[model samples]
Each structure stands twice: as C-alpha cells, then as structure tokens.
Target: MRDRAEITIVGAGPAGLTCAIGLALAGKKVVVREWHGDVGHRFHDDLQGLENWTDPVDVLDELAAIGIAARFDHHGVSEGVVFDGQAKPHRVRGKRPLFYLLRRGNAIGSLDRALLDQAVKAGVEVRFNDRVTETAGDMILAAGPRRADIIAAGRVFDTDMEDGAWLAIGSELAPKGYAYLLTHNGRGTVASCMFSGFRDQASHVAATLAFFERHAGLRMQNPRPFGGFGNIRLPRTAMQGECPVVGEHAGFQDALAGFGLRYAVRSGRLAAESLINSTSYTDAWRRALQPGLRTGVVNRFLFNAAGQSGLDWLIERLARNEAGDTLAQAYRPSLPKRVLFPLAHHRFRAPLIDPSCNHENCDCVWCEHGDHSAAIAGA
Candidate 1:
C-alpha cells in the first residue's frame, strides 16, 4: 500500500478489483497487486455467465444496487434449447435474460477489461506482475480458486451458424454436471463441464461435440481446445487472520451449476462495505449470500441423488418453468432444502488443500500452490 492508501488488495480478478474500485470511490486510497502480468491471466477468451435468474429481482437492477454498472460487452440470453438424456430438445425461454454472456480475458470488450477500466478510472492504483506472500494488515485476498472440484473441456471456434445457446445432459456427455454450446455473432464455444472422470475428458469432449453436431447442425473452423474448472464450496468463514477473502479464494461459488460471477461481485461489494462502515465482512456476506448458496447445495444434492428417470422428470419440470421469474422461485430456499442442508453441506463442501505444487500446468500462484490449471482456449 502507498503512504496515502488505506488498503491493499491481493489479486486483480473481479472480486479484488471491485473492492478496490469501491474503496477508491469512497475516497480511501487503495492499491491492488496482481501476480499475473495483467488481469484475467487465468482465462483466455473463454465465455462465462453472470447468472440472472436465481434472484427475485432482475440481475441488471440487482447489479446497479451494488454499484457495478454493466459496462462490458455482453449478450442477454433470454431464450435457448436444453436437451435431456434421450437427446430430446426442449425450448426454454425467459421473460428476462436468464444469464448475460461475457468474455473473460485481458482484451477489450471482456468483463475483466471492463472492471480493470472501472478501477483505474476510480483512482485505484493497480500493480500488475506483482505478488505478496504475506496476508496481513488491511489486506483483502481475492486470489481465485485453490483447486478444481469440477473440470471442463472447452473449445472456441469460428462458425457460420447463427447465435444460440444450448445445454445437454447425460453421463456420456458430462458425468455429473452438464455440457454447453454458446455462440454469438460468428464465434462459438463448446464445453463439457464434468464433475468426475477428469482423466477421460478427451472422450467426453468428443462425444459432446458429436452430439451437438447431430442435434444442432453445428459447424466450426479453426477450432481450438481450452479448458477451465469450478471451485465450489460453502466456506465456514471469509476471513484470513484479520483480512477478508473474497471470490473463489473464499469458495464463494454457486454449488449447483458452478455459476460464480454473481457471488464474486456481491461478495466483493460486501467486503468493501464492511471496511468502509467498520463492520464485520463475514456477517455481512453470510446474510446476503448464505441462503442462496445453501439452496444450491440442496439442489445439487437432489440432482445427484436423482437417477436417470428422475433426471428426465426434472428436465420436463424445469422446462415448463423456464422463464426467469418462474424459475427463480424454484431455486428459492425452502424448508425441504433447509432440512437437507446439514447433510448436503457435509457432503458437498470440498476439503481445503495445502499450497504445495501438484502439477506443471502453469507457473501462476494457483498452480504453484497445488491447484492445476486446465488448458484453456488460446492458452
């Protein structure tokens, strides 16, 4: 931190950057340190979503409430197709956007670049290609995931096809999770997000591609393979010593579908508010995010316990309530989900790992500290 800065934040990802922007805007001099050469170093041009349907309010309005403007290039996906185990396609539409599509990278038009621009404009000093081992003083840690609880085999390619979003469900396609194909303009991305069988991902990826081709009349050119992972956990605390940890570093991710951008932004804002108001970050975030996170755990647990036929039945039911408002209610926490939470929490939360090298994927802090980075698009 500089002589005038009141706080230092580690990592330049969304959470840390959001916090820096907030603190800086509040007239508190803030500095952000990033280990990578620039923001979004862990990602390439991979597509990610800012889920909009889980909350009762419109996601855009919700974001405005927290002071994060939608300044990045994004497409609102209000309609899409979902395929069940038997390869039967169902049309799913939302009254509002189900999720906003975003590009994750350092390039212009990406979400990372948008936040980086906002932070710089707010007078937040950002030091790239920097690292600090110590976790002390008025510091916040937003250093991404520590492990891969779910890995994805993804590809980005050029296509002549029209804009569309498609999701497929089946063991052959994506073990316990799901496979997705999203396209806008002329660019396309395909990924099989799997929770198990990491070693046999090649076959899973191939099968997913073939399935989409057969069903959606997909086409591609200059296809490049990239990969990523989701680190989902309901943390017991969001503090490291006296500092607050935000985003994936604190395991603040959606337990059901691995949608995390919403959680990341909200947690970052709460962390900044706590610092600004001299309140407790842990208490603040838990009140805001805990219910939905616990609901996600229960949802995933039920989805897991459901067999093939049960999954088919679920697909039928979900398709009927595809609109954002109708679907959001289904995800709302309930007594049944609450009753199952203790068990789900126990079963779903991943164990913490020591920061010891486990693979030679990348030399970033995450990989050096034992988290394996997958080969991503353009990596």
Candidate 2:
C-alpha cells in the first residue's frame, strides 16, 4: 500500500508514535508503519523502568509537560537492595522515588500501547505489519536499538514476592553490566545484562538465578525465558539523508544504567518540533541531550574498564553516604563536573577508538568526535 503524508515515521515505538502525535496535533498528516502486529510487540513480559535523577523534574511530569497524556500508572520505586557480589546486601533508600517501573508488552496498559492510543486520538494514522524499506516526504526513523552493545537474557515468572527491586553486580552474574530482579503484584522479571561475557551467557543467567534465589528469596513458578539487545552509542548526525533517527537508534540511552524511555520521549518530541518549526534536529538534540549522553558513554567506559573490583569500589564509595544522595549525584547528568572537566583531565577515554562504525547504528567515533579517527572518517 503506497501513500503520502506530510511526515512518514518508521517503527511505531515510543519515539515514532510520539512524533506522530505531535505532528498530527499541529495539523500535519502523519503516517506510521510498524513491522509488528501491534504496539510493544517487540517485548514480552519485560519490566522496564525510567530514571528520575538525571532530570530536574520527574519523568512522568516531563512527559506531561510535552503534552503526552498517556493513561498509564508509573509505579514509584523508592528503595532497593544492591549487592557487589560479596558485601552484605547494601540497602539504598531515597527520600523520593528514584525511578518508576512499567511493563513492556502489547497489553492495554503497557507504555507503548498507551502512546499508541494518544497518537490515534491526535489523528495519526497507523499501519500495522506494514514494514517499510523506503519512504518519501520528511521522514522520522524511530526504529528501536540498532546493534547489541549489551545482550540481555530475561525471564518472566509468577512469583510470591511483595513488590520490590533488587540489583546484583558480580563477574559470575553479569560481566560488565548488572543483573536485576523486579517484582510487582505477584509477577516478576529477572534478567542478566552482559557487557563482555557473551560466550558464557547461559552460565551467567543460571548463576544469576541461583544468586537471587539464595539472596533475594525469590519464589516463582512457570518461568519463561526471553532475550533482547541494548545499544548505547551516540549518533554522529541526527539526519540520515534528510531523515532524523529517534529513540535508542540515536544512542539516547543512559550509559550508567540502561534507562532510556525518557530519552526516547524527549527525542521524539524534539524531532517533531524541528519538522514543524523548520529547525535543525541535530542542533536541537545536541543542545538538550548531547551533554548527558556523552557523559553516559564515558561512565560506561570507566565502569567496563574497572571490571568487578572497580565496580565494587565505586559502589562502596557511594555507600559512604547514608542517604544514597552521593549515588544519585554520581548518576545524574552534570555537564561541568561529571563531563567537561573530567574528560579534559582524563584525556576523554572511551570504549571504542575507531571513528568508523556501521552507519546504520550511528555509534561511531565520527558521531561523538571521540578521538583522532573522526578527523578523517565522516558519518
């Protein structure tokens, strides 16, 4: 089915749908093409959450400020237990909600489904199972993550838990990333995100299960296994031949933790604003999000390099403060302290040195201007 509109968005995820809604409300005809049957089809019973410390305001409030009135409950998470593979369970508690949890599925209440509803209400036309390779008119590529920087093995199960979250860090469970168990309303999702140890993934998953069982006292039945990939590289250019990429495809993910829903929503709205106001998408995103994202990449590199011992050291350092305030400050996006001067002092270290990367993924040296390679390589 061939059609034309003022704007054509690919992949009906948070970013694409948000863009559609914004453009539609502005009286522009918008069409969205989805490869899957419905919204949130890419995920199963995965329990995802958005970070709150980075932004000055709450994530839900930020969404509301952008006129996104999705009717979904944001489960506030105020406290959690962290384990550094050995130390007695370190309990971190905050005065306010540290994050908000949501399910990832096509259910009526899922975040993706909620966004779709809002988009439709704004007169955005959505075509399901209409995988598109090429398109005409102003284009927005809101496709999900591009490459697998960290592969996650997840499981959804019926558990007798009383609603809580637990994060564990150790070489045996997850190499560079962390393993988390989130339970709510008698259901739970447990996953091991691996950064370097891809070959021993199964073993890592098994070890995570065992560790949680012993430490968290997790009781479950009928555990179903699933997996997905996460990409955390920044894009060199926001435009691909006049098309702007949004969501995780633009590397708008948090480097310290894999929280990106806020970034997805923010980028989508920014993309739509650019299209309507005849502004530069790249400049807009750079002004709003580039600093935080670049800081995240540096944090990711340092965390990976530190390995298990370094991770333990960092956590212990955070534990020095009783109220978990230091930890929050460490994770929050601070341009002057965390990024600029730190990078200048340390010579701007990164995980990848080469400027050339697959253009589709956009996590290249050219995109971030990381080092020497970007001088010759163009994105």
Cα RMSDs, all models: 4.7, 6.5
Relative to the true structure, candidate 2 reaches a TM of 0.86
Point out where model 2 deviates above 4 Å.
1-5, 320-324, 332-379
The sequence of per-residue lDDT tens digits that candidate 1 reaches over residues 1-379 is 2243369898899888888888888888888988789988777687777898887677778767766687888999998988988899988888778999999989999999999998999998999878777765688888787677666776888999999999998889887889999999898899998776565677889999999999988898999887876677877778887788888888788777888888888888989898888888889988999899899888888778887889888777767875676668767989988999999877774322222223444332233333344211000
Best model per TM-score: 1
- Give residue 209's lDDT in candidate 2 (0 to 100): 91
**Model 2 Cα lDDT, one tens digit per residue, 1-379:** 1234568898899888888988898888999988778988657757887777776687788888777874875588978888885846887776667888887778877888889889998998999988766645678887776655666776889987889999998778877678999998888889887765555667888888988999999787889986766667667786777788888767677766777888898899999899888888899999988877777766765676676777777766655654346655665566554545455324333432222334344432222222222111111
Off by over 4 Å in 1: 1-4, 349-379
The window of 10 residues in a row where model 2 has the poorest summed lDDT is 370-379
Cα lDDT of model 2 overall? 0.74
Q: Count the backbone clashes (under 3 Å) in each candidate.
A: 4, 1
